[model samples]
Target: MKFFDELKARGIIDALSNEEELEKKFNEGGMSFYCGYDPTARSLQLGNLFTIITCMRFQKAGHKPYMLVGGATGMIGDPSGKSEERNLLDMETLKENIDAIRKQLGLFVDFECGDNAAVLVNNADWWQGLGFLEFLRTIGKRFRVNEMLNKDSVKSRIESDSGISLTEFSYQVLQAYDFVTLNKLHNVSLQIGGSDQWGNMTAGTDLTRKMNQNQVYCMTMPLVTDQNGKKFGKSAGNAVFLDGSMTSPYKMYQFLLNQDDAIIDALLKYYTFLSLDEIAELDSKTKNEPHLRLAQKSLAQEVTKLVHGQEGLDAALRATQFFFGEKIENVSDADVASIFEDTPSVELSSEMLNEGGVIDMLSETPLFKSKKEVRRAIDQKGIYINNVAIEGPTQTLSKADLASETALVLRKGKKNYCVVKFK
Candidate 1:
């Protein structure tokens, strides 16, 4: 497929300027395209996932993808899609955030080789040294205040009860400047971003055309959302972060694995590099036996491997096995720790287990919320020690209760499992 055709097939093209001309330019090769990322947070969420993926596609198709880190612009937050002006990040903090984000982007796009070799650029390089009068007289004159104020991003904020600040209101000019700088210095012709960024991206295209009389292109990708129409990053109120420190690989894998049948196909197309045949086959299997959840498993596995590594993928898989009624006996202690590191656990002394019955131990951890629930589950043959169901809450702790001499896996039911460790 042609480069842009593939993008459209994958639904990555939310909007693009002069589609015919841009496609022709891409076909000529060595076309420089860029998408900017502001460091609003320490880590990028799922909303940013599509843009990075699209950038990769452009690179693979023989176009250079410049990943712009808004080191200078992030200090003045973009007003797009905001109810109120944001609190600015200090220069020290913005620099740190820019470096962290650059590292994250490095994982997605390979900048070392090929005609489509990716590169990271910071606007701070140019925006930092410009004199106040130089900026006002040169780039600032290209934008009209009347036209800027009428943009959707500005208009919505202005019409809201919370008024906009000059810092945020001038955000478009800074963004437009980034585009013009890239176009002149690096010959960057294309600017890509989210749908909400259409206004800012076009502002860049227009600025390039007016200032340099150069034809620049712009494109955006739709927001990655769940079938329920809600955003996709939240895992029970906590976001699924790309940074392993923020969200562990095991948890991140599980979040993708738990995707409902309704959204798996669309997400696979957007997130994974799997061929259409493979996706269609997975889709077929999913429709045949929705219970199997094979597609969701593949999605989780692929994404985990991409963000984390093979070791992280293995950890997530091991975690999945434990959830599928498997025991911790054959698993390594390190793997066990990596998986259940976040699940609540109570460290028990060996003597403590010896002194208390199963009921007392269960109650001590507050696993059941009450002793009565623990007794009821045990009486109903629902509670398990290690992987085997318990007959009664009165069962005494024996040597068999400990797994690998350090851990105990308790199954409250099919879904709820707890791990207890011996210090």
Candidate 2:
């Protein structure tokens, strides 16, 4: 399949400025394109991952990628997807976020490859030196208020209870100039963004045409949404951040692992670099044997490894094993905390270990109601301390049972887990 055709086939390309021309250009040869991200938070959300992967798809097809960190535009706050004005980000936070995201983006695209290697840029690099008056006269004059007012992003804000700010109103004009700048600097011919940013993207194409006399193009990806059509991101409910600290590898793995079968295919295509044939095989497995959850497992593994490294994937897999009643070994207190964050927990004094055997201790907590209940569970080999069934009702507690420094993982069965923490 042709490059553009395959993208459409996968539903990667949602809107294009000119389909025929863009398709021809895409097939012709290696060209330069760009995608922008704003430093709105300390870490990029899963929604932004869609754009980064799209850039990778183009880069693989022999195109150069210019990843523009919206340092300048972020200061003004793009009104594209907002129902209300966003609180402006401070310089310190924005710079910190930009640096953090730069490292994350590098993991996906090759920076060492020769001509088509990825290049990172900050709009602040250009905007920092230019004075306000020069910006207005040079780039601002081209955008007319009436046309800007008609843009869906702007129009929606105008109709809202809190009207758009002048700073936000000029965000499109600033972003539009970014295309011309990239075109002048890197000979970039195309720009891509999420569908919600179509208006902002078109403004860039139009601005590039008028300012630089370059027929640059814009394409938008449909918002990476859940099956219910709600936009997927922090605001969508769960803040599935790419950063490990904000959202643990276990949580991230669970998010993808629990994806609905209805959208599993699209999730696989969008989130992973697995080939169409590989995805097709998974799709078949899903239809024929969804009870196995092979597709969800693959999707979880691929994305977790991509965002986190091999070690993180291993950690997520280990975390998964733990939930299924595997013995916990060599895991840290923080990891243990993350694994059973949502499960019930029973805290005990470190002194209690000296007073009780395993059954005596188990009976004290809510894992079992009484000593008799605990003994019966042990008789059936159904009770576990750190995933090891008690040898008998008389099994004693010891320091060796602690999975971490001060925590012991307790479970009644495969699904019921409770953490026993030493106070």
Candidate 3:
């Protein structure tokens, strides 16, 4: 398949301005393209993953990709898809966010691929030195206030209760000037963004044509949403950040693993580099045997590997298996802690274990409500110590039973589990 054809086949293109011309340019090859990311947060969230992957796809097709960090524009937030004006970040926070995001982008794009290697550029480098008068006479003269007001980003905000701020209202103009600057400095001819960025992206193309008389292009990918129409990349109102410290690899894997089956096929298209035939095969299996969750597992594995690398994927798998009757006898203390990080836990002094056995321990902790409940659970063979079924309530917890001499794994029936840490 041709490069552009593959992009369309994978459902990556939401809308492209001047498709015929862009298609010709793509076929000729060696076009430089850019996607802008604002430093609004400490890490790029799952919402940003699709654009990064698109850049990777373009780079693999022999095009140079520019990862543009909006250091200047981030200080004045973009109003697209926002309900109200965003809080401005101080210079310290913006710089920290830019540095962190640059590192994360490196994981996705090849920075050493010779000519086509991805380049990281910050808008602040150009915007910082321009005086207000120069900016007004040069870039500002090209924009009309009436046209700016017609933009969806501005129109929606103007009608809202909070209204629009002049700072945010001029964001499209800044983004437009970025295109002109990139065109002049890097010969960048294409800009890619999310569907919500359609207005801002078109503004850039327009400014580029008016200023440089160059035909630059803009393409957008559809905003990802779940079966319920909720956007992806959020968990409990907080975004799923790319940084492992912000959103753990284990948690990211679980989030993908738990995706609704109804949305898995579409998600596979957006999230993975798997071939269409491979995805089709997985889709068939999903329909035939939904219980196995073949598609969901593959999506989790592929995306987790992309974001966190192979070792992170392995850790996520290990964390997952820990709950599914996996043996805990040889598990490391840190691994055990990570696996049960979200599970119920009780810390007990080392001396408590010597007073009695497993029965005495359960009677004291909240794992069991009362001694009678503990006895009942043991009688039904529903209790496990270190993943080994307890013979009865009398079966004692010796030092030998502790995994890594730090913790004991206790389970009730098939799903519920708790960790007992010895201090």
Highest-TM-score candidate: 2
TM-score of each: 0.86, 0.92, 0.91
Residue ranges of candidate 2 with Cα displaced over 4 Å: 353-356, 359-381, 392-394
After TM-score superposition, the amount by which residue 135's alpha carbon in candidate 1 deviates from its true location, in angstroms, is 1.9
Candidate 2 all-Cα RMSD: 2.2
Tell me the spans in candidate 1 whose CA falls farther than 4 Å from its real position. 233-238, 329-359, 368-382, 385-409, 418-423
Question: TM-score order of candidates, best first?
Answer: 2, 3, 1
lDDT of 2 at 304: 91
Candidate 3: regions farther than 4 A off:
234-238, 329-342, 347-356, 391-408, 421-423
Which structure is stronger by lDDT: 1 or 2? 2
Which lDDT tens digits does candidate 3 get at residues 44-94? 888789889989888988899999999999999999888788889999999
lDDT of 2: 0.87
lDDT by residue (217-331, candidate 2, tens digit) is 9899988877677777765566689999888898899988988899999989888888888999999999999999999999999999999989999999988887777888677
Q: For candidate 1, write residues 218-288 as lDDT tens digits.
A: 98888677656765443224477888777778888888888889889988889999887899999999999
Q: How displaced is residue 370 in candidate 2, in Å?
A: 6.0
TM-score of 2: 0.92
